[model samples]
Target: MSVSKKKFNLVVLDMAGTTVADGGLVEQAFSAAAWQMGADPESMIGYVRATMGESKISVFRHLFGGDEGLAQTANAAFEAAYGERVAAGLIVPIPGAREAIERLRGEGRSVVLSTGFARVTQDAILAALGWEGLADFTLCPADAGGRGRPYPDMVLAAFLRSGAADGVQEIAVVGDTSYDMLSGARAGAGVVAGVLTGAHDKAQLVEHGASHVLGSVAELDGLLGELERSS
Candidate 1:
């Protein structure tokens, strides 16, 4: 891995299942929408659970390949259902996540959030978390004009937006899913860390190329500090 002269410059976070508590609502919504759109229930829900960190449209497209209109309809239903769920319930922040983020910011690290949810659902979630403007930037796949997790686009977008032009290795990406780990690794981030707070466990994360596996994002600050000192 390339080492940066500056320990680290940016941290790209995954919103759901990392900074925010997911509690499986997104999977529920996605599964429901897919079933309504004529997908087989058994395979559909499983696929969704596996790719929950991915963009809704991407999952739909993969499931309903060549049926762009059907995929679009399913995506709309997912967003609508997910929006309603958020509006009706009290969404909570993951334990210690807000504090950890604040600590990182105190140390002059640029932090941003990338999510699979579209802008509308992300907006409702931010409002619920009271996390508006909490990060330097919060991005959806659409915001960066790229496919979501497991792809490098969103992480690269965060790197650019956070002013990290020279040292890609000075960037860290943290999330609870293997997709997030893959995204960070594919983007050539120095620290592709995975947390167990959302989806995958330690083995799954490691298999996906996570260099550091924490119990949760709560450990991120300390982990980075250790990396900085070790470097």
Candidate 2:
């Protein structure tokens, strides 16, 4: 499948595994959350791993059989555990991630960082990385009406809030998870790119909906350049 290139003015990037290296903190936190909720961590780990970029709350809701109260409590536990890890400096920006954002912004693009974690956890990550205002905007599921990856809501919200592109086809979405690719494709982004620094591999990413597969977020600027040249 050949994809025609177009210049994108809005860039929506996934947080963990794509731009931030959380060092498997998500699974660790999920295990703790599950145990706290009287669920077997080993039994739930597979689903947790499979839904890497989906909203944590949504994952809990599924795991808890649609019991909203249980899901909410489990999600709170997960967020607290994750936030504590972030506060402990367990997370780091992916190599050259900050530089890539700066380069895109320098080239007149608006960059928005989106994540499946809650807002509090997202803020903790930003605070840990000292990236309080690095991107034009930061988003979590709650900010986009409680939907995350595999849904177009957050991407669409970024597109609507940034006012960076005239249409969805002028937007670029990059992440490391298949869910992220699906979200981008569903949102009709011009460039639905998958990076290899996170959970899912190239095949899974492409299988879901990635238009491009990159080695890492660092390569994104080059991808955009290549697209521009082809255009």
Candidate 3:
């Protein structure tokens, strides 16, 4: 379906897998956290891999069988491990990610970088990548009332905070996971695009409600252009 360019004035993007490449750090950190809490990492890895775009605490809450205390401790450890890796310079932007954000903004869109990680870990990544102010704003679960992907809170938060879009239908959401697609769809975004650069595959993305699928976020601006022409 073709959409008007004016329909997507606010762009919400996922951080880790969509814009930033962390080299499987999330799984590694999950393993470390599991081990620290006396759980077998192998036993929980499948679920971890399946829910890539979910908030870490939420993931832990499920893994720990709704034990909030255990979930909190595990989440803290995961953040710490991930933070250390970021401090060691272990993350990099997906090629053209920075350029994509610039191009989107250049076209008068308000770009928001959203993440499933806690604020501290997200901040570490921004600092490491020198992306402190690359987007109009950044969001984590806490910024959106402690809910994340698969619930739509973060995406809705970005829409409300940016005020760049007149309504949910004016928002564009791009990410690399099924959960990201779900969040965007649930939030009633005009365009929920999935990229192949991270976690889930094309089928998974489509199954989760992606309006479009692209090779990478670098193609986002081009996709918008295509949408304009088709419209």
Which segments of model 3 are wrong by more than 4 Å? 1-5
The regions of model 1 sitting more than 4 angstroms off are: 1-6
Error of 1 at 5 (Å): 7.7
Q: What is residue 93's positional error in candidate 1, in angstroms?
A: 0.8
Worst 10-residue lDDT window for candidate 1 reads 1-10
Could you give candidate 3's per-residue lDDT for residues 124-210 as a string of tens digits?
A: 999999999899999999999999988999999998788788789888899999999999999999899999999999999999999
RMSD of 3: 2.9
> Cα lDDT of model 3 overall?
0.93
| Higher-scoring candidate on TM-score, 1 or 2 | 2
Residue-level lDDT of model 2, residues 170-230, one tens digit each, is: 8999999989999999999999999999999999999999999999999998998888888
TM accuracy, model 1: 0.94
Lowest-lDDT window of 10 residues in candidate 3? Answer: 1-10
- State the C-alpha lDDT per candidate: 0.86, 0.93, 0.93
Candidate 2 off by > 4 Å: 1-6
